[model samples]
Target: MILFENVSKTYPGSHEALSNVSFHLHRGDMAFLTGHSGAGKSTLLKLIALIERTTRGQILIGGQNLAGVTKRKIPYFRRNIGIIFQDHRLLLDRTVFDNVALPLIIAGLDYREITRKVRAALDKVNLLNKEKQLPATLSTGEQQRVGIARAVVNKPPVLLADEPTGNLDPELSEEIMKMFEQFNQVGVTVLIASHDLELIKRMQHRTLVLGKGKLIAQFPEEDS
Candidate 1:
């Protein structure tokens, strides 16, 4: 489970990125976060990913309070969390297989195990054949799938996506969201921060809205 209790963040100029935000995401739950460009969506995801520390309040992930998690221990904290960035941060110089294998490699998994996991993740995204291809050789949508594969290669229990569909067309966005649904169906907690309201409305998942460093609303899809 993920919990935020009275969390807030402020920049050097006193520009608030998050203000007294508090919420709970249960294990295996799926939710979306939406708002305009300056909304605290990205900041919220950052806090969850441990990429940014909350200026105040507490965060609990998987029963561990983030306040007690030291900076040096951050890497260990990330072992069970997966993050997908808007940019698809693939290594242009590497093959898709290697890129996706990064996390497993960092964990020093056996080569055979890494290969098995990478293949499984790629298969989930239907990009198994593109293993030898460079990220630059693929289209934007395919590259994004590569990113997703990389994020899930470790089989993390929690997944965080920041504007994952920002670079895709509506159709592609639907496809990607469906992929996320597939992951959630298999029991991975998923939280996506995006601005594609019209596109996501059809998917019918819960949505958390943010504005000016504060959570304004939460839309829980009745269909789910």
Candidate 2:
């Protein structure tokens, strides 16, 4: 669950990236964040992930105030959230299995458990056979799936994606969205920031829109 109370984020030059944006995403809810470029979508996700701190107001995740989270506890806190990027962000040199296994490794799982989770994640993305391959050897869409696999390999409770389907074709984009749906059905809270209005409409989930630095609209499924 996520709750933002009058949250605002301003940069060093006093450029406010978010202005009094507030919203509540209940546990297991799936929503899309949409707006024009520079509309603070990424900033909002970063605030939740603690990549950046809020300039004002407060953020609560599963009842834990992020303001109280110390820098030393960031890594431990992140274990509850999974993030996926549009660029795939895979390691060029490592095998796919290794990349997906990184999070579990950091969490100190043993080799057998890591192997099992890595294989299961790859299977979820239909990339189990490609586990031994390097990132460069995969196609664009395949690479993105790899990123998704890596993000969910740890089975985090909340998932955040920034323009996840930006680089893929329409069919691939739909496939990626369905993957997120599958995760959500299993009770993973999903928040995706994307610009594809048509795709968002097709998904028919809750949508939150932003303009400039403010939350302009939030539509429930029936209203969307």
Candidate 3:
């Protein structure tokens, strides 16, 4: 559902985030973008999320060229993708339900449908009981789960997670991974940027490794 062709990113001075990177992700597939610090994983995600435009190359999402997408249309393009972050990025002053319901409200869904989808998403994350709680009131793991709920509440076609498990213990990290796996099973194209080698080794998904802004090796899954 996503393709990057001859992609490169260079900063104002001499910094390069990615260089001539090209890859394709098919719909319903799950993959990991693995690299150490400053490897441009987040840069790649930002490009997809349209937070940053590439200095070079073309990006296509389901055949629409992002290079030509208008600023006014950016929001429409983002509606089909969900993004999760390491920081949880929740608004502490807002209740959990409001935070998760933000997207639906923006999409102009009626209150009844909004209530239904938001609650269902919270239930999937096993946080339905804490719907009324503020983000500060939940534990770190629970707050992260709430972040996941907000991301997926819109039922987006693609999921982008930037170090979603970075702040949690191993057990809680695994729990979050399983939640992502559940969504991937139902056809959310999942791309996670993570450096957790131990957890990644256990998942056994296709991995694309990058370093110093260059393409390294994309290790295909066995039995492929």
| Best of the candidates, lDDT | 2
Model 3 pairs whose backbones collide: none
* Candidate 2 lDDT for residue 90: 92
Tell me which residue pairs clash in candidate 2: none
Model 1 lDDT per residue over 19-58, tens place: 9998888889899999999888998888888888889998
Superposed by TM-score, candidate 1 places the C-alpha of residue 95 at a distance from the truth, in angstroms, of 0.3
Clashing pairs in 1: none
Off by over 4 Å in 1: 221-224
Q: What total of clashing residue pairs does each candidate reach?
A: 0, 0, 0
Candidate scoring better on TM-score of 1 and 2: 2
Model 2 TM-score is 0.98
How many pairs of residues in model 2 come into backbone collision?
Answer: 0
lDDT string for model 3 (1-224, tens) is: 88889999998797899999998889888888989989999999999999999999999987889998889999988988899999989989999999999989989999999999999999999999999999998999999999999999999999999999999999999999999999999999999999998899899888888898876878783242
Looking at candidate 1, what is the lDDT of residue 190? Answer: 95
State TM-scores per candidate. Answer: 0.96, 0.98, 0.97
